[model samples]
Target chain A: MSNLVQTITQSRIWRSFFRHGWPDNPLDRSLVMTSNIFFHLHPVKVNRKSLRATYTFGLGVMAVILFLELTLTGMLLMFYYAPTVERAYTNIVALQTQTPYGQLLRNLHRWGAHLMVLVVVLHMARVFYTGAYKPPREFNWVLGVGLLLLTLGASFTGYLLPWDQLSFWAITVGTSVAGYAPVLGSTAKAYLLGGPEVGQEALTRFYALHVMLIPLGIALITSVHIWRVRKDGGLAANDDR
Target chain B: MTNIPTRTPFSKSSGKTYTLVELVHRAPAQMIDHGPENTVFAFPVVALLELLLTLSVSAVLLFMSLTINAPLEEIANPNQTTDPAKAPWYFMGLQEMLEHGHPTLMAVVIPTILVLFTLAIPYIDNDRQGSGRWFTSERGKRIARNTAIYALLVMPAFILLDNSFPPRELLRGVVPDFVAQTLIPGTIMAAIVIAPLLVLRRSKPNAREVVLTLFTLMFVSAIVFTLTGFLFRGPGFELYWPWNMPDGYNPFMNL
Candidate 1:
């Protein structure tokens, strides 16, 4: 088994695929992080203190995981959904009852949206309580707040996609709150709903935001948020001891 | 300008290996006041931990998705509004706030100010003394706990009191609209938020302590408002016990 693994690793194709050798040695391990895009968000070394489960409760990472889950399930849901006042509700019914595992898909997306909002809030609380937002990380915290808002946006836009009475009324109420703003209120509400009320135009706009605009913003901002973590010296816990 | 001689590995005259030397003694790599380096490579350890977290979170989400299906109510009807007509669960806090005062103040102004204040916290408390420590110190933790307790008691009381005798309604003819709707409720909320900071001023609290007090107040108050708006509000958007919600209106369905 070892020989087979070595042979494959030594092959040109495998070497080209992974620039580093097996990550058993220090040099290869460092290369593994620096060379890979996904792993590059992390530093080559992390302080032992930061790894404690109690310190972070892993809420930030859980938020990211939930985001990925939402993205996947959301894409699948899109395959069965259409953003129209007439068909949106029926499409949801069909998704739940007709499509295979469609109910589970919608369920995961729905629950994940709620969970992401929750975990992001908890993560912010954890950061604040731990003082992780202190110097050099202050901007990261700001970005995180931006990300939190984006998460809310993503979830809110998705909320109207179901087109049921729950979504319709919830959105009507939500957007009306925006209309309470002083000068730009009505304009913002009209822009959001594509009119004075939730209708086909609102559905189209929300669909665009839920699937494209907000998720893209989240993806881009999340990258910056994690990259800033590495640049700002891993976790704030590194300064504890 | 004349060029300065650059050091070389080999000497021209001797045609032999040469060296560039310095006479000064440099400081060693170690330094005082620096603690022992305690760290681990991120590749295996962090990667493994993240993998474990992802799997566990996914499992929990899957279990939840399987057991409790997401709510899908009747078709959209513009003419017939839901009893409460609440926002998404996350925005329920803001909606609840709207019940207390004018929509502009309760929904827009206060929430906007809170968001801006939250974003400004790190800048406001820029001292680097206790970056990683939970609640900064013993005093900070005590302040946070007390502030939380205070908010826990005060916010619910405020909610219930304000609900029972809403200034917006009770003082409608007694006082000006601005005073009744905006000023009264606004002043009360400001007092609730600022009372702890006023108390902390006597002790000459550090920036961290002050932030702890303020954040705890805000965080706990948000919880109170959200819980009230979500679980407690029932038909006609009126406050009620969660289990006793009228017309079979389950708040969880709003999720």
Candidate 2:
């Protein structure tokens, strides 16, 4: 049995699948992390202070996790939802009452979105209060502010999907604020709503933005954001100066 | 027992070529005083923590989804508007700000300034000394705490006082629309934000400390305005106790 196991483990196919052997030793452990794309964002070795629960309270991790959850649940919801003035509300009603576990999926997406916004805000507060945004981490902080705005954009766009009165008026009131801008106010508002007010054009635009554009921007920016965190020498908790 | 060779090929004693270049007196290049003993391999440790967090957060969200249904009101009708047509909860701060001053100032200018200021913070306070520690020092902690409390007390007072005795209403035709809606409210809001800094200015605060005051004040004021808009306001967009909203209006139903 041992001989057969060793033979399989040393085979070229197995080696191709995993670059490193069992990660029981230091060299293999380092290879296990540095060799994997997902793990490469993390350093092979992390400062113990940076890992302490109280230092970060895991808020950044929570935000990322919430984003992933929102994406998952949102993808599931897309199967049932259609962005149109007529079918949108009806589809939502059918989704809740007809489709299996559909209401649950919608609920997860909704709550997860709200939670992501809240968590992202709290994460910013944590970074600020910890003085983590100082010095070398400046660009990452700016990226984070961008992420916050994108988060708001993502949530606001998703708000209009159901074509319900709540979403309609909410978005109308929301976009009217954009119309209060100096020169580009009315033009920007017109572009956003696709006309004078919320209609099928607005729904279609918000659908593309909420599903494709904003999430893509978030994912791209988030990749760079986390990469910058590692490049900036892990969390500020690792710093002694 | 047979005698074994002490100097193995890879052993230090059998070194064929080696060099001791130069000795430098400084902390390590990447890590300051930290050594191997102060760190851990990120493989299983960090990865497992992340997995555990993912599972727990998913579980909590599942529970919430099972119990609470997301709100879906009547179908869109351009003619029939809701009594209090408010924005999403997050934008409630901007909506509430619209109540206080000119749309140009409240919705566009002030928020624009705040966002730009937020982005400019690290550059403005480019001090590298207090990067890791919370509140940087005891003085920073006190400043943050005091600023938060001051915002908590003063912002609501401003909102309430402004709501009751609106300058636009009182000075109708007596003052220019710009003065009543824009200049007066703008100056008052700026003064409220700057008062704490002026008080701290006597002691000559560092950049980090100054930014700390400004950020805390804005953050707290944001929360106050959001709550006021989301919970306190009711139909006709008038102030009421959150629980005492008339016409059976539940602010939470909007969520």
Candidate 3:
């Protein structure tokens, strides 16, 4: 059995599939992180201090996880949802009452979105309180601010998708605040609503942004964000200099 | 099992080694200050931790989804407007601020300033004295705590005071619109924010401590306004006890 396993492991096909052997040793462990795309976001070795629960409260990780949850549930929701004034509300109602576990999916997406926003804000506060935004991490902190804005954009756009009274008025009130800006307010508001008020045009535009543009932007920026963290020598907790 | 060698085989003591070169003062190597003694491989540990977090978060979310349904109101109607329409919970801070001052100042200008300040925080206070520690020092922690408490008390008072005696209404004929809506409220807010800094001047606070006070004040005030907008504001946008909203106006219904 050992000979057979060794033969299979030594084959070209297996070698092509995995760059490293079982990660039981230090070399393989290091290789495993550097070799795998997903694992490469993390460092080969992390500071023990960075792993402390109290230090970070894992808020950053929680934010990323929540984003992932939102993405998954969001995609599932897109299958049944349509970006139309006529069908959007009925789609949601039918999704809740007619489909199996659809309500659970919608609930998860809605709450996960709220949780993500809260988690992101808390993560920023944690980073601020810890003075983690110092020096080399400054640009990453800027990126973080952009991420926060994008998060708000994603949530705000998604809020209008249901085409219900709650969503419609919430967005109207929200965007009216934008219209309060001096020169560009009304123009920006018009562009956002695609007209004078919330209607079919606004719904379609928001749907496109909520599903496509914003998520892609988030994914791209998140990639750079994690990469910058790795390049900046892991978390600031590890830095004594 | 093959042992991975970390250090190079070539050494100064070796008989055939090259001559010693002068050490140059340059940026230190990656691991100069710390060693592997205080570190662990991220593969298994971080992966496991992430998996645990994912499971726990999902479990909580799933339980929430099962127990409580997401709120859904009636179909959209352009003619029939909902009384006291509000923004989402996150933007409730801005919405609440709208109740106090001019919309341009409350919604646009102040939020823009806050965002810019948030982004410029690192540049504004670039000191590296206390990177990893929470609140930087004891003084910082104290400043943050005191500022938070100050904001919690002062903001509610400001809201109540401003609501009861709105300059926009009180000085209708006496003062200009901009003066009443913009200048007066803006000046009062600036005074409220700057009061702590004036008190801290005696202690000779550092930039980090100063920023700490300001950030804490703004953050806590934002929370106060948000909670007030989200939970306290009932039908007609009047401040009420969250538990005793009139006309069966449950604020959670809006969520």
For each candidate in the order shown, give its overall lDDT on alpha carbons. Answer: 0.89, 0.92, 0.90
Predicted candidate 2 versus true structure: per-residue lDDT over A13-67, tens digit per residue? 9999899989988898899999998888889999888988888988899999999
Candidate 2: which pairs clash?
A: none
> How much does each candidate deviate from the true structure in C-alpha RMSD?
4.7, 4.6, 4.1
Q: For residues B112-204, write the lDDT of model 2, one tens digit per residue.
A: 999999999999998788878899999999999999999999999999999999999999899999999999999999899879989999999
Model 3 C-alpha lDDT per residue in residues B136-168, reported as the tens digit of each score: 888789889999999989999999999999999
Per-residue lDDT tens digits of candidate 3, residues A1-241?
A: 9999999999999999899998999999999999998888888999999999989998988888999999999999989998999999999999999999999999999989988999999999999999999877899999999999999999999999998889999999999899999999999999989999999999988998999999999999999998998888788888654
Off by over 4 Å in 1: B1-36
Query: What TM value does chain A in model 2 reach?
Result: 0.96
**All candidates: TM-score:** 0.93, 0.94, 0.94
The iRMS of the candidates, in order, is 1.8, 0.9, 1.2
| DockQ per model, Cα | 0.74, 0.79, 0.76
Candidate 1, residue A148: the lDDT equals 93
lDDT (10s digit) by residue, model 1, range B14-108: 33345554433232211123343687888899999999999999999999999999999999999998888989988999999998999999999
Candidate 2 clashes: the total is 0
Report the C-alpha displacement of residue B94, candidate 2, in angstroms: 0.6
